[model samples]
Target: MSIDITANDFLMGGGIKAARFDTIGTTVGGPITTQPKVEQQKDLDTGELKFWNDGKPMMQMVVTVQTSLRDPEVPDDDGQRAFYIKANSLKAVREAVRRSGAKGLDIGGTLTLTYTGDGEQKARGKNPPKLYSATYQPPAQAAANEFLNGGQQPAAVPQQAAYAPPAAPQPPAPAPAAPTAPAAPWTPPPGMTPEQAAAVAALPPEQRAALGFA
Candidate 1:
């Protein structure tokens, strides 16, 4: 943050030695990092307006105006204030600039004003800094497609379809047998076959001839 001091602070910091002001703004040749200057139509044609291109306007300016914290969004008429601040009244700001050791003080950058917080002096809005900046954007360098594509090419894709797995099947069951009934009680015959009976009969006849009737 820039240290803002009051007029008394400037006096305490050290008394002023010398200061310079131009009727017009400085000439801008190439790109400027930072500098202290006020805005004015006359300042535009002054020594600071370098790299003068007649075609590109809006970018052109008398001087780049610096802003105070209170009016950062909109730069107050600091160039006008600078013009108004006379020889004796400007002592504090001049000394503050000297103490800073910088070559110049930009608008809204750093300054020692002639008022105090509790003193009779009421802050008339707020004094803008002495230094400021402005950016002159050279027209767009690339086209929309150039920005979208940069340096790369589009990727390739396949035409064939993808493979899928087959589905599973189920199994069948067996048939049942019929139930059987219980058997009844029974008896077997004790008699012999017909052939055995014939043999016995013939033997009996032979025996009967020998003995009495068989």
Candidate 2:
């Protein structure tokens, strides 16, 4: 009698690393087969669970993608086939998926994430957050069949249109103010005494204007 074992039986779990988007234009992408999971946030320095001031642990959503994409700074033999995304970067991917009319991200589709630029600066002396853009390409019929056939060659498929986010709205320009007539030149009243006229002349132009002398 013989026993049959599939390749997945010998696969090890854990050790998957997150992808980096440290610079502008940096991109990473892969096919998403599973739904995103939520987990407790961990402290970067100590690898301990991070908690809020009220004693509750901070939570974060994780989306893992399987791909051959590798960071140039990492070693070739690292065998890093999967990467996870969370935090603000995850928001971008969620928005893209929503805009694509998909109910959720796990559509067995490819997800591309690009670091577009830096976001608005927060408190003074603190670094600005990184901004990202995402694109989701649904799996083609040929590609799905190729996977089911155990790595067989896939048939050619027509190109699908890429998604583009709408531009930000701008504030309308202000309207010009109406032109005003210049004030008439000031003169002393004809019935005033010479002393009174001299006194009025001694006052500042603004005071005379306020007193209806202008």
Candidate 3:
């Protein structure tokens, strides 16, 4: 019988402690099982800046997601798997898969990872704890008069951020507003999870009729 843990035992879980961000949704037990590996992001200011830059251990990109998010600390009724690590959270899931027009980034699509407290506060004074900005979306298209709306089935997408050598074009910051729909109460879209509707009924009837799910 020996147990002792400090830091006030993590404040005894009294709740009301906001400022730990990262919990937006739209995954619901299927698609995007894995991709983007490259780990080794030791916290504590990258372990004190990798001890004067010899250790070189600050990388990210984890990216796994299975969302439902009723989240009483994620008991797993096929929900809340969560990862999507840094590099600005994988560049907001590759700009929400290029705004869902998607030329890439899929795997049972329907991403929508939002958090946006208008970001920018990683450090700098009194309370300093807000760097929220994730906002992805990607996976919505079944509007030919919504035939019982199947909408969202792209699957197998995760490969961007590699061709970067063009730096020098700053001065284009004025086009933000239009992303509000993730206060987090998810589980829609025929609300999947009969193991995501039997993995979209075993995907193959013209790829489930081109993702509209025939």
For each candidate in turn, the TM-score is: 0.19, 0.51, 0.22
lDDT of 1 by residue, 1-214 (tens): 1333343532232221122332223222221113322221213346442333673322211112222223244354232222223223244445544555544444323232332212233367743333422222111111112222344332222235787644445434436666666533211112422432233334334342232212
Q: Write the per-residue lDDT of candidate 3 for residues 1-214, one digit (tens) a residue.
A: 1123334432332231222254443222223444324444555544542322776666544444555445566354445354535656466666666665657544444444445444555667744332333434323331221223445443433445788755668856669899898654222254454545555455445555565555
Query: Per-residue lDDT for 1-214 in model 2, tens only?
Result: 1123233421332456677777899988776645555566677879898898999977655555666666576676342344344556778877877776666555356777889999889889977988888887544421332243444332233355999755657756658977988956545554544544555566566555444444
After the best TM-score superposition of candidate 1, give how far the Cα of residue 120 lies from its true spot, in angstroms. 16
TM-score of 2: 0.51
RMSD to the native, candidate 1? 51.1
Residue runs of model 1 more than 4 Å from their true location after superposition: 1-83, 116-214
TM-score of 3: 0.22
TM-score-better candidate, 1 vs 2: 2
Comparing 2 and 3 on lDDT, the stronger one: 2
lDDT of each: 0.30, 0.60, 0.44
